[model samples]
Every structure is written in C-alpha cells, then in structure tokens.
Target chain A: MIEVRNLCKHYGARKAVDDISFTVNDGEIVGFLGPNGAGKTTTIRILTCYHPATSGSARVAGFDVLSQSIQVRRHVGYLPETVPLYPEMRVREFLRFRGKLRGLARGERETCIARVTERCWLGEVVDRPISQLSKGYRQRVGLADALLHNPRVLILDEPTVGLDPTQIRETRSLIRELTRDHTVILSSHILPEVEATCGRIVIINRGRVVASGTPQELRSRRGDGAVHAEVRAPVEEALQAVRELANGAKVTADAADGWTRLRVEATGDLREPIYRLSTQRGWTLRELRRDAGSLEDFFVRIVAEAQMQAPQ
Target chain B: MRATVAIMQRELLSMFCTPIGYVVIAGFLLILGVLVILTEGFEPGQPATLRNAFGLMPFILAFVVPAIAMRALSEEYRSGTIEGMMTAPISDAQLVLGKFLGSAAFYAVMLGTSLVYPILMQVYGSPDWGAVLSTYIGLLLIGLFFLSVSIFTSSFSSNQIIAWITASVVLASFAVGGFLLVRHVGGFWRQLIQRANVMGRFEESALGLFTTGSVVCFGALAGLFLFLTIKVVESRRWR
Candidate 1:
C-alpha cells in the first residue's frame, strides 16, 4: 500500500508537485493520469526516493519515504520515464548486476534473474546487449530490472509511452498479470491505455489532483445521462413531452421522413422516462438509448476546468 | 560495504568492457617509459634510484588520472543511470567510495605495469628496493588523491570533457599551478602551498621518505574530496 499526503516538491521557486495527496491500496492497479509537465514524473521520482519532497510526507509499504527511504527503496521497484539502462551490458548481465546492487546473494540473483526473464518474456534476448534490443525489448529489460527483487510496489512512469500498438497491447496484458502480485502504480497521459488497464484512475492537472475514481465512476460522475429517442409523434409534442420530463435539460426535436427524433441531455439517467413517455403517448416507439461519454472527454474537460480555477 | 564492492565491480566492468581502459594503460605506460628513458634513470653511470620516475607522476597524473576517472559519475548522469543508482538501497558514500576505489585500482594496475622498469634495472643495477617500494606507495596514495578529486569533479557536470577539464585545473593548482605563486610569496603562504604540494610530497617520498605527516596529509585531502563528492551526490536528492 502507498499513502501520500500533501506531497510538495519545488525546484527553486517553481512548484513541480504542488501539494498532491492520494493513496493506492494493496492489490490495486492505479493509473496516474496527467498531461505533460503536470508533475507526474516528479511525484514518481519522490515516491521512488529519487528526490525528497520540499514539504509533506509519503509512505510506501509501511515505510516513510524520507526517514525510511532505504527500506522504502528496498520494497519499491521503479521504472523511470525514459527507461534508464546500461546499453553495453547483456540483459542477463545487467539484471545480475542490479540484483547484486539490490543485495541479492549469488544463488538468489541467478534465480531472480531467471524468474524475471521468464516473466517479462526476456528469455530469447537475455544474451544480447541492451543496445541491440528494440525499444519494446529495452522497456521489458527495464521492467525486468525492476522486478528482479520482487518489490512490493512496482512504480512505472509512463510504462507504455513509446511502443507499437501490438507491443502496447502486450505490455498492457503483462501489467495486468503483474497486478496479481504487486501493487502497481503506473503513470500515463494516454486515456484509453489507463481506461483499459487500470482498476482506478487519478487525474492530475497543474500539480493537483482534479479527480480520482474507477473509469466507470469517472465517466458516470462527469457525464450525465443523455437519451436519444425516435418517436412517431409530432416533432413539437415529442420535444415538449421530453422537455417536461427533463426539466431544463437541453432538449431538441426534428422530424425526419415521418419520424420525430428527440434528444434529451440532463444530469441524471433520462432513458427510462423517455421510454415510458413514448409508450404512454400511443406513439410507435422506434429507438431509445444513451451513449456514455468517453474518459478522454472527461479528462480534457476536468483538466481544463482545473486550469481555469488555478491559472498559472 | 557489500554494496560498495558491487558498485566497484560495476565501475571496473564498465571501464574494462571498453577499449579505452586498455588504451589508457598502454599509453600511460609507454609515455612514462619514454620519459624515464629520456632522462637517465637507467644509465649505468647515474644512481640506481626511481626518483626520476616518481617525479613525473604529478604532471602525468594531473592529466591521466582525470582521464581515467572523468566518466565515473558523469556518464551515469548523462545517460540517466544515476536515477537507477541513486534509488538503489546503497548510500551515497558507497557509490562515491566505490567509484573512487575502482579508478584507484585501475591506476594501481597501470602503475604496476611500470614495475617492468625496475625489473630491467635489476638485471644489472642494484635499484634501491626501499625507494622503489616507497615510490610505489607514494604514487598510489597520490593516485587516491587524484582519483578522489577527479571523481568529485565528475559529479560537477554530466559532460565527461568538462569533468576532465575541471579535475585537471583543480589538480594542476596543487601540482604545478600553486608553485608559480609559491615562488613570489614568502613565509606562511608559501609554507602552506609547499605543505600541500603533490609534486613536492611525491618528490620527498620518492627519496625513501614515508613520514606519518605525509600520509596523513594526502589521506586527509583524499578523504575530504570523497566526503565532498558524497555531499554533492546527496544534494541531488534535495534538488
């Protein structure tokens, strides 16, 4: 489990991570969603003990990030944004070196190396130098390096920032599989990537959290229910009836080839009301449905809203 | 300590894994050989001593030691591997000490190869084993001093060339640069300059002199730089 409270990191006079607070429970796969320069990387670095916060506190795996940083580091596996790696060393060599640095004994190092190699699909390229591997393979090697010690928390910064679609799919599946053993906290700007992979999402803008919830919850909370209806009644009557039910919802109606099409947009689910109204009016009901707004739109809107509230 | 050794091995691994390590050793040995031969260290008529060889170190080490130590931390910074290294369970002291020891060990090997000269001299001339041992010990101590300064400078920038230049300029101030001011000044200032002079200490110790004061002085300076490097590294976490 990871708990962060009022975490602030400043570089000179600029606030990189400005008083952000959140938590990730055990067996949870959380996505840190943010735009560029939104302090995603800075927060990750602080959590990994790469840098200390200017004020506030963070604890990882029951150890404080500042006072118990060594213990925190021991339990944390970090894959940085750029996938920092030694280019000359072979995959196995690099893993062994990292395992040794992580204080793994000889036998444990080899076994850990083998386990990660197998888990991360690094078996075929274990003998090749890191420079020779493709970008996807290099990313896997970085992930393998992080997994060498079986850390309690796996913190990945933009785990799939640069990859082909197929590789992205593969990596997403691998991350999902890893959620069984590790409390995974990954940061990404890609909306669908997080929507598809993570169980919970924390969206940040201007170094502060704009919103946090599951993908379904964020969509439902931000995007009120809008119903689309097709009725054989007159366009004016259909519009008035839906407008009366919607009570200030943006209702529109138009007649197209003998059918009145009505749209009712409001803060709550209006589909059932529209269906009952269409059936009671003795009109032939044709179509009634609602489209859930994509997380992309919600992400853009909240981030823009946050920006307007606190102008930089 | 185990982490320190692990880092030291990685340091050595990076150095020897490239051709630069071999090239440097060969070049330093060849240059030292030519310089010793050009002087009369092996001449039958001259005294059988290694004073001339040890005398050349401050000048050569002012260039070569930094060349060897320049990339230790600088490359890690430039390549972004420092993020990985700093986040590991090891302390900053282990990281700094490991890199310093690795470069010093490489210097030991480079300096060890030059022992061929005394062996050749032993074929006919009775080279003073006391001066030989003291000279080697003195050079290694100075090498530690040089490696610490160079590694400290390596932490100053991500550019290896900049690190090399910074280390060279700082070391030159003690080895050669300080002498220019020492001649013009008198009394305490000159005494202070002479007291910390690397070339002067090596020259004195090259004549079979191994005083506790000399060891303490060089050892303290090396320790100071190592401590400073650790501080600079630790400061990164704050920034």
Candidate 2:
C-alpha cells in the first residue's frame, strides 16, 4: 500500500512535482500516466526514497518515506527510468550483489538469485557481462534486479521504454503476474501500455494530477459527451428537434449534401432518444454515433491544457 | 551492516575484475621505483636507506590515490547507478564507508606489493627498522587521508576525470605545499603548515619519532572527508 499527500518538490523556482495526492491499495496495479517532464518520474523517486519530497509526505507499506526511508525502501522495489547497470558485472553476479544489498542471507540470496534470474528469463545471458546485453535484455536485468528481494511494492518507471513489441507484451504480462504478490505503480507515457495493464490510471500534467480513474470509467465519463447524428432532414427542423432532445446542452448543425449533421452535447447517453426522434421525423439516418472518447483523447487534452496554462 | 559489506565487496570486485586494479598497482610500483632510482637511493657509496623513497610517498600518492578512487561514486552518478545504490535500503554512511573501505583495501594491496623493498633493505644493509616501520605506518595513514579526499571530490560530480583532477589538485597542495611553503614563513603559519601538511607529518615519522599526533591528524582528516562524503550523498536527496 502507498499514500501520497499533497506532495510538492521544487527545484528553485521550478516545481517538479506540485501539490499532488494519490493512494494505491494493496496488490493493485496503478498506472501513472503523463507526457515527458510531467513529474511522473519525480513522484516515483519520492515514493522509492531516492529523493525527498520538498513538502508533504509519502508512506509505503505504512512506513514514512522521510523518517522510515529504509523500511520504505525494503518494502518497495524500483526500476529507475535509466535502468543503469555496471558494465563489467555479469548478470548473475549483478543479481547476487543486489541480493546482498537487500540483506538476504547467503543461502536465501542464492535461491532468490536463481528464482529471479529464471523469472525474468535471463537464463541464456546469466554468465555474460551486462555491457554485451541488448536494450531489451538490459531492461529485463533491471526488472530482475527489482524483483530479486521479492519486495511487496514495485515501482517501475517506464519499464518497457526500449523493448520491441514482443518484449513490451512480455513485460506487460510480467507486471500483471507480479500483482499476485506485489502492489505495482507503473509510470509511462505510452497510452496502450497503461490502458492494457493498469487497474487504475492517474493522469498527471505539469506537476498536477489532472484525472484519475479506471480505463472504462475514464472513457465513459468525460469531454463534452458529443453525439454525432447525420440525418437527411431540413436544418431548422432537425435542429429544433435535437435541441429539444438535448434540453439545455449545446447543439450545432452542419448541412452537407442535403443531410444535416447535428452534434448535440447531451448531458447523458441520448442515443436511444435521438434514435426515436430521428425515426419520428421520418429522416433517413445515414450516421448516428455518440463519441466515447479514448484515453488518448484525455491524455492529449490534459497535456494541451497544461501547456496553455503555463507558457514561456 | 550487510549492505555496507556488500557494497565494499562489489567495489573491490569491480577493481580486480577490470584492468584498473592491476594497472593502478603496476603503475604505482613503476612510479615509486623510478622516483627512488632517479633520487639515487640505490646507488653504491651512499647509505642504503628507504627514507628518500618513503619521503616521496605523499607526492606519489597525490596522483595514485586519486586514480584508485576517482570512479568510486562519480561513475555511479554518471551511469545513473546511484539511483540503484541509494535506494537499496542502505544509509548514506553505509554507501560512503563501503566505497572508502573498498578503495582503502585496494590501496593496502598496492602498498602491500611495495613492502618487498623494505624486506630488500633487510638483505643489503642495516636499515633503521624503527624509521621503516614508522614511515610505513605514516604512509598507510596518509594514503587513507588522500583516498578520503579523492572519494569526497568524486561525490561532487558525475565526471570521474573532473573528480580525479579536483582531488589531485587538493592533495598536491598538501603533498607539495607544506615542504615548499613551511620554511618561507615563521611562527603560527609554520606550525600550521607542518601540522596540516601530510609530508611534514611523514617527515617526523621518517625520523623514527612515530608521533601519535600525526596518527590523530591523518585519522581525523580521513574521518572528516568520509563525513563530508556522507553529507554530500544525503544533500542530493534533500535539496
């Protein structure tokens, strides 16, 4: 479990992470979604105790990041954005080293090393130096290192950044599998990656959390609720009928090739009522659709809005 | 703690696994031998003593110790492995101590190889065993002080070359400055230089005095630098 309350981190005048709060329950995979330089990594660093928050507080597994950082670190495993590895250390040797730092006894360290090595699919290159491994394998090594201690909470910042499509899928499944025993907080700009794997999504922009919800909840409940209806009817008549159906919501009409394309910003799902009205009007319906915006729309909208709010 | 030992072992492992460890050892021995031969401490008709060779240690170590410790924390910062290291449920003191001890252990190995020269003195002439022991003890102490200084500089940046240059410059001041500057000034400045300068303290040890004051000086200096390194590591997380 993790809880962040009104956390703020500033670099001189620049606020890297503004006042933001979000909670993640045990065994839940929460995706921290944001574009470049949107404070996603900054927030993760605070949670992992790599950097202290400028203000407020964060707790992981009931331990404060500031006071009980060592305990917080023990409960959580982090795969940093860079995924740095010692170029000279062999894969197995690196894991063994990580295990030691995690305070595993000799026998337990060896067992955990083998288990993580096998789990992360680092079998072939176990004896090879890290410098020789490809990007995908390096990412796997980072993953394997994080899982070496069998930490209760896993924080991965862009876990699949350099991986090819297959590797990405494998990593997604790997993260999903980890939810059985670990609470995962995955941060990434990739829409589908978060959409596919995370149980809940927290969208941040310009050091602020813009929206937070499940994928389906986010898709269903946002952004103008615009319904598009193309009917071969007179503009004035259809506009009047749609305005009546839409009630107080905004309505716009565009006539093209004897068909009036009506866009009604309905307060709720008005597809059923709009269909009946279109039938009653005896207008030939060419296209009738309600826009259920994707997470991509939400992501782009938040970024664009944040950029406008803070301009050079 | 286990974390500290693990980090220390890894640092030592890194040195031996790469050519850096062997190169540093060989390079130090070559330089020390060259300096001794050039000073003509081994020529005939002169008193056979390792004092001249021992006296040049601070100057040699002004370069050698930095080379050994330049990559301690700077490389980790550059490669972004500091994140991995700092997040490992270990304290800053553990990280700094681990690195310091690792470099010190490597220095011990480097110093260990040169011990044969002292033994060689045993074969040829009746070298003052007191001065030899005192000089070696001083060398070990001053070596750690130089290492601590280098490790401290290494914490300031991600560039190992920059760390090496910074540490070398600071140490070369202490190594070359005391002998060069002490005689020019009198009174408090002279006492200060003699007290602060590693070579000045080594001169006392080489005279077979083996003063405890010099041990305290080097020990306190090494401890101060190690403390500063821990603070620097903590400072990054704070501000």
Candidate 3:
C-alpha cells in the first residue's frame, strides 16, 4: 500500500535521508530498524507527508506524497515518535477531535472512536486527561489517534519507547493484531521488539538502507553459520578431539574447570556429527545446546561492520 | 472551512480551560483601570470617556497580544505536538490560520472586557459615542496586527519564552516608533519614521475619523504578517 522511490532529504549540506526506496504490501507489518540519527524518523516523516522529500517520489495508498498529500494523509494513520496530545484534553474528546479532523462523518467518527478505544485498550482511560496518563497509556492514546480514522495503512515511529517491558509486549501484540487488516510500518531501535512483531525488517544506517529482508533472511547474511555448544567433557581432551573432528572448520574453544565450551562454524547444522563425536570420545555431554543466531546478533554484526568501515 | 473551524474551536477551548486566559484578561483590565484613574484624572460626578481608556491601548497591546499568542504554536513545537499536527490531514494554511485566529480571538476577548471602561464613561458623562466606536475599531485593528506578528514570531522557535520576547520586540517597534516622542525628532529623519509609523495607522480610527487609508493600512499590515507566518510554517516542514 506504500511505495517510496529513491527518496532523498537534505538539511543544507547534511542529508538526513539518502536515496532510499521500499514498499509495503497490504496487511504486512514491516519493521524499520536503525540507531538514532539513522534517518528512521526522517523517512517516516516523508511518508506521512509531514515533510517534503528532497527528490524522488513517495506514494501512500496509491496517492503521491507531493502531488496528492491530502489524499495520502487520508489513507495513512501516523503516530509520531512523541504522542502529540494536548495535555488538557481528555482521551475521548481528543480522539473525537482527531476523527473529525480526518474528515470522518459524525456517526462514522463516533464508531471509529469507539472501535479504536477498545482495540488499543484505551477504554479505561477514556475520560482521563492526557497529562495524567502513564507512559503506556500515552502510547496507546497515540495509537488510538492513528487508528481512529480507520485508515488502510499505519505508520508508527518507535511505538514502544519508554514503556515498561510488559507494556512493550502489550503494544507489540496490539500492533500484531492490527496486521490483519492494515499495513504497519514501525520504526524502532530495539531489535527484539521488531523481531517479535514484524514479518519483514528494513535496516537503515547513516541515511541509507543497509539491508532489507525477512528476519531469517537477514540472519543468514551474517555468514557466521556458527553453532555454539556447551559440552561437559574432560577440558583438554574434548577440546583437542572436537578441533580434529571438525576438519578445516574454525573452532574457538574456552575451557573452564570441568567442561570445554566451543563454537564451531559449518555450512549447515552439525549437531548430529558433534553428538556422535562426543559419544565416541567417551566425554560426558552435560550440556550440548545448539545455538541459532537471532536477529539481534545479525543486526549488531551488520551495524558494527558498517561503522568500522565508515569514514571518520 | 470545517477543518479551520475545528482547529479554531479547539484553540478557543484550550485557552478558556487554563488560567492563562483569565490572567491575560484580568491583567489587561487591572492595568487599564489603574491607568485611566491615574492619567485621565477622574472626577466623582463627571461621565467617563474612552479618551484616556484608548489612549494607552497601543502600549498595552505591545506586550499583551504576544503573551497570549506566544504559546500558540511555540508550545506545540517545543512539546513535539507540531509533529502530530503536521501528520494530521489539516493543511499548512489551516494550522497557521487556526493559531492566528485563536490568538486573535483571545485578544478580542481582552478588548471586549475594556467595554466596561466605556460603559463606566456613559454612567459618568456623555462621551462621544462615535469616537468611542472608532476607538474600539482602532483597538480591534491593532489587535489584528499584533496577532499576525505574534503568530509569525511563534514560527521562529519551539521555545515559548524566545517566541514571546521576539514577538514583543517586533510589536514594540510599532509602539516606540509611533510614539510622539520618537516622531517629534527635529529633523527629516523624524518625518520619515513618522510616515512609517504603525501607531499612526490607528490615529484615524481612534479620533472617530473613518478614513479608508488607515483601515487599508491596518488590513495590509495584518495580511503581510499572516502571509509571513504561513511562509515560515511551510518552510519549517522542510527543515
């Protein structure tokens, strides 16, 4: 439902968003992963029509961001990094106002308000002043505002920031629920949050798209293909035997009092061979757990590699 | 139009909900009353006239209107609410005009309370009704100018204090340059400054002379500032 092509945004000499391009299909949740100042928010702003792209084109729900911004705005619901709420306004009133501003008819507005109030779990705080709400509720209020118009696409920038762990989980589930009918583009620095919530991930660094794919796809790109195993064997003998067994494989070994810890890199799963080796060597296998690198590991390795290669 | 009215109503509601609105109106009234009593030389049985009441309006407006409008967009910017607003379906013009009208409406409320001064005049003496009406017209016109200037100042930064000071400084120029003391400079420079004076634009309306030139002058000045405000707001999105 969204298409961005070679978008560039510059502030004088510094480019905040480089020539980036991406697309979001209907009912898919996409995560924008980047550290601070990585142009995540800048990209979101361009898609929302809050700011103009320096060059190239962005279309939301089939409307051009520059030529048809109003129509684009109508089709997309946006939750900025900070929830823009008037402190004095109560929740219900604020949502109602937002609905009307989106040009919802009277009855339609009321129905949408009620629907979002329930969907975002805002019913309890419906009458509370925004200033009195907890961070979690404030985040929900932001979500509710975006959903009130019932737009086909939702763009949320850091939807889970500053919330407690439980609140973050709740927000994640809420976002996941939204995927049934709406396309979601969420930007966040927390890798696990994105991994748990998004079907696809787009990693950005220094105003450019570094990588974009499914979590599993990005993880495979790390090329480590390494599996970590904790084998409780005679410290010296097990390390020597495992090193010999995995011929030509790079194995890093760490020996403690009783057990040897080893990381073995192979083209594919070596769990069966490693187990057979341990048995043949007559070593006590106390803890032999296979490790699959997660999205966090994948993200850190990529970003750190990029940073090292970057010019000062 | 519906969007404009929605924003205007929200702004008006926000103003009335807080003590800032009350403080502004009460402060203006207290200062106006005290100034009339001290400068106009009150008499026990004589009717009150807006002559002294409106005489000090230009000076009061220099600060009052900016104070009222200082937080309109500046606070939204500071608090990051502007991001929310910009993401909304409302156009840039709607946002700018809404804030301008919201502040202007507050200024109008401040001016409306001063009507008590004229009513007090009727109770004491037969003040010229025509001059009183013209003076109010003058006050309203001045209000429009200050509103636009303050809204434009609000666009400069997210800092409300900075916005207030900047707007005050810009608005104060009209008061200072228009003052007779400044205009009375014994040189050609005085004549030039006097011709450019904003307070001079208020002269016809205050004196009960319904001059088209003065009316046009205030209207154009207000329009100019409002246009500037819209431009600044639009430019900020790019930056």
**CAPRI level of candidate 3:** medium
Which 10-residue window of candidate 1 chain A scores lowest in summed lDDT?
A220-229
Candidate 2: Cα lDDT at A210: 87
A246-269 in candidate 3: lDDT tens per residue? 787888888888778888886567
The candidate that achieves the highest lDDT relative to the unseen native structure = 2
Interface RMSD list for the candidates: 1.0, 1.0, 1.0
Each prediction's DockQ? 0.69, 0.73, 0.68
Pairwise TM-score winner, candidates 1 and 3: 1
In model 1, the runs with Cα more than 4 Å from the true position are: A229-248, A254-261, A267-288, B40-50, B123-126
lDDT tens digits by residue: candidate 1, B36-100: 88787878789877677668767888888999999999999999999999888888888998898
Candidate 1 collision pairs: none
> How accurately is candidate 3 docked according to DockQ?
0.68
Docking level of model 2: medium
Ranking by TM-score: 1, 3, 2
Clashing pairs in model 2? none
